[model samples]
Target: MTIRSRLLLTAAIGMAQPALAEVTLTRGSSPVPDGEALSTGDLTVQNEHLAFTIAVDSQAPWGVPRGAIVDLAPVTDGEIALDRIAFADFIPNNWSAWPNTGREVEIVTETPEKVVIRITRDFGEADIATTYTLEEGSDRIHLVTEMTNRGDVPLVDQMSGFTLWPDSGYILPVPGLAGVDSGSAEDALSDRVVAYDEDWFIALHAPYFDRVEYASKDLYATHTLAPGETRSFEGWLQVGPSGDLAPVVAAEIARGDIAAGSLAGQIASTSGPVEDSVLVVEKEGVPYIWTLTPDGSYEIDLPAGDYSVYATAAGYSDSAPQQVTVAADGSETLGFEDLKAPGLLDFAVTDSAGEPLDARITITEGQAPLVEFLGRQTFFTELDQVGGVQASIAPGDYVFTVGHGTGFLTEGEEVSVSVASDETQEVDVALELIARPYENDWYASDMHHHADQLEGTTPPEYVARSELAAGLDVIFLSDHDSTANHGALAEIAEMRGVPFIPSAEFSPSWGHFNAYPLSLGEPLEIDTSTATAAEVMAEARRLGADAIQVNHPFIPYGYLASLEAGTVPGGFAPDFDLLEMNGPDDDDAVFARAAQFWTQGQRIFLSAGSDAHDVWNDNTGSARAYVHVPGGVSADGFVANLKAGRAYVTRGPLIEPEIMFGTELRIAPDEERSLSFDLTAVNGLATASLIGPDGEISSQSFDKAPSTATAEFSITATPRTEGEDWVALRVEDTAGKTAYSDPIWINPLGEPDVLSQD
Candidate 1:
């Protein structure tokens, strides 16, 4: 007999009952209480090795119990672990939103071998029924779910699965899975299953690692259910201690019988033919990988079963999955072709002088964005293993929008292109580089960024290349709490002729700060490194940071904000030189908080960064600081200029405001100043304000239309009562983009210049 059959017979003989055991189901308070969330139901199930409480609770979404606290622990001689595993009734795609746990939970059957519990939740147009069977002898649970669509419309691409969190341990991917990290909290996506091990191992028979919640990993499957039809699927979870996974994996391999079958497909591409493309074949929810032929055709040998097949490539829109079924044992052929293809978008960017210019491109159809490449300065015209600006786009009518940064300005062009099947269209974009007041001396920099940190493995060379592509004059390699790749990236930066700033992100629970001129030999730990923010800031200063900038001060755990709430140990703020006022997107709250601190007499310089991780998905220098490095651009020189407060941070809009007096930009008390402003933007300016210690002293509205891309302003102003009253220029474009200049301080009427100026 098979091992499973033999074990079943033994278990039946030892534990069989004369009749079904009486199961008394009841609703009670939460078994594992954490907060003020309302409880739905509590269930207790015990076996020789495990005792778990399935507590249902309502949190986040209203009127629904979405959280399933699987308070599970190992039981030894009736004793259980203090820590328990808690999870929720989470669907992989619904990790962000809480999924509804049915209005009622009931125990339908109870026996020595199994306990079957049924849960039903009513949707507005449909309802879902999930039955969980907790079996004896093993910690594995069988989940059989059925969803009936009662509405007229058929539901498509529905993802449903459990979100589980084990108390401890990381998830190991399945063998031979061809996928990368999903870039969420989840560590990875596997082809067949994911295993979690702490003191014991729990294997989930699901294909995708959806996300991570605290210490737990979410595993799920995707399906489509037609209206008035019932769709059903089975999921399994097996558990054991240490060396017990061999049999489990062996059993699963046996269950998935190897069948002889062949798959054929062709990729439709307008750019001659698709090469180096991939065809993903998911069999019974497990993804199997295969490479496509050079002419966009593919053939695969797969096990006999049902499969969902799709095609994918870089810069191409993903194709819809085609369902196919194969016969077991016999040679069968399945065809998945005649699908719509993606077109090729080959474009180049340059300045009016025929020199490459860093720019951002957006391809959109009506209101839907197709492909977007932000902060792209250099274009690679050659084709090789690694890709360039060339994109394989979906066939459609798209509007191409392009904009430049810093020394370059373009009203932002919009060209309409109709992409047809199997065609390569080449387009050229030329942006005009305007010579501002300090044109030859200014250098743009993004001080905060990350790569290959937990989520991705973006290499050091790619990092340097991304910086050049974004047209950044300088980039600081500040991976979170680690400077592992600083030296390697610095070498690449040197090769690319860009200044590299060696830095580390002291990302602590209380706050995050960047330390420059990083010493790699020094020890740094995420936990137990520094107890308080004060000590961490002190450590950064000791590490030779010319000036420490508070990162994202308005976000959660942001230093200045956390300090205000007294969350950090120290009551007083740290002695930092700069404040990050900009990131990928504009946050008015961050700018307001920084301005409040400065207006309250704090000496702070403003800075900006893209905070980009994956350059393919993000824009480098979407927001950047332009430092006036008149002494020539060097890492030390740039840091010195930042410390001297001779810089302005901008997003899209370009503004050059100057107070023509001394090179130091200083004036005596009540001194008259002749100010000149040269501003140009893809979106014209709305208003320009001159802010002082007591708030706005004067403001001017540009007379040009909101769409006007360029303008200049020159006006004179005088300091009223100069006791540390600093004057700064702030401008806003019609599109709500902003730029901020460093403040020029007016010395007190009788006081002498205070500290040594940069």
Candidate 2:
């Protein structure tokens, strides 16, 4: 029998009747009044081991009873012994919110030598019972659970549950299952702060870990259980003292790798040709169809509109959604690409020394060539596999070049190619690289996050790995009110060459603010964290931060407004510089509002932040954030871009709207100044804003750029009291677009002869 089954067996058999004293004082005292079957029937033991006590306070349904305790430091019984437990100190630590924990608890030691622990709130109760038996000269503990409802119906499949051990750090046994659903708290999707959320448990949500949560790369999984009418689960909690127990439990659960479960939904039939076990299709209101079965000519009937279909089997994947406009005939072929779909070629790069680079490479204009492979049209690409390179292409001829940041490849390096869909082709190119004129650089980083562990969530590696993959320039580890994980991430980022800024998301009663360059210690823990909006600005300056940023101001975690009261106990206000105008997957409202607030919060510099704990979905960020250093891309480069106001956020467009000497320049203390744009429409519409043209003080309305019909328009600058000032336009439009020009220094005429011309 499985260990779980065996343990549960003991619980069931012992509770067959409430007779026999049902408990003993092997190590402590109880609340059952010792030999008296008293009132609510709750059992407890206190100071049973060393100086601590274990208590289980049970009460009548919908009510709380008094707790009983027994001090164990005074016990001298050496033969029947056990360690003490602290059930009351249980607190879940994770990124997302879970059920509020309950208080009153009770632990029972039955006469037949069984341990029954029950924790209750006014609404419900959960019971875990274990019996110790002597077998073959060894003592075995059998455990089982029985839960009851104090209200009308069963508790909805909930995210309520808890399990922990002594802080000394022991590996959790495997071959076992979580009492709550085994979904996940964080995964590649939540950026790991929620930690390790995977595709398997689409709806289930209680996360499970084997010793270390990250062991899943080796430990595998199968279908997760859903809560039904009295559904019972079983597993073995193999005992082990140390080391990762993932492989050990995985092998014991199933002999081989066939553990991922099959879906029972209507869409399960469509899952067959999918790769990586993932399917991505965008529809207005309908959900995507998923199939767990292995083969079928799946047909999707849809009402016309724009859509994207991505299918994956194992890890092979394909994507491209279409927006179909039905003709007068009211029909169209929303082609489902099988092996016959347009081919995708993976490209890779590395350093001049031939090291492989993990970066996003874009192919534009359909001007790139195609190659043939396996008797079909295909595109060729490459991946840096252990320092080597390769490519795949559809059968065709065309010229190709690279864009965005430079790697082993340079800009405008054209290549012509042709291939038959039947054969594989091999190609290799070497690169000569150069550094930028500037010595120092700037960086990019996400500065807000929370840490939760009692919930089996918050895998730190996901936070580290996603940024590495997304090409984020840097990251600031700022857990609210603490820097506990700072040392660990710093060491890890160094190995990855990404700067780990010591930061704090300190808040006051007004708003949330971030402090950077704070020496990787406790420089900014707050009484509020998001309380005083102004204080955040002041703190950033006091701490010598290169920049201060405000975190998500629109995420209504049920506190859209009315947080000034303790109703929203945790938030605070803070000081700042830059503001997060954009985050990963920020919607238009979120983006627009952030921009509006930053414009209103004039003294703060504005920037984009992806409060992402996961970067598994960063494909939309191709043009992400790139700063054109008068040098190379690095942490220093990112910071410099922010300080000089040379940074613009985008996924596509590159805009360059500058000021000419005569047409766009004017100088006057009280009168408005005007800056002109020679303007070039490089890719598409570029939106520009005149920033701090008035003494590091932004003129209102600079946040949202009015839709511009032409490529250039003169922003009649709003001038503030100024001596020698700065002015520049920040612009960006739809897909892959952006532009930030150098600031112009406007010198007022009568302010002393300040002209020094050679």
* lDDT for each residue of candidate 2 in 89-175, tens digit (9 for 90 to 100): 221121112122244544443333345444433222332222211111111112222233334444543322223221112121121
> How much is the lDDT of residue 354 in candidate 2?
74
Any runs in candidate 1 off by more than 4 Å, and if so which? Answer: 1-336, 340-347, 358-408, 411-427, 434-438, 520-530, 583-602, 660-672, 706-723, 748-758
Top candidate, metric lDDT: 1
The deviation in Å at residue 696 for candidate 1 is 0.6
RMSD for each of the candidates: 14.6, 16.1
The CA lDDT of each predicted structure is 0.56, 0.34
Clash total of candidate 2 = 128
Model 1 is weakest, by summed lDDT over 10 consecutive residues, at 369-378
Report the C-alpha displacement of residue 525, candidate 1, in angstroms.
5.1
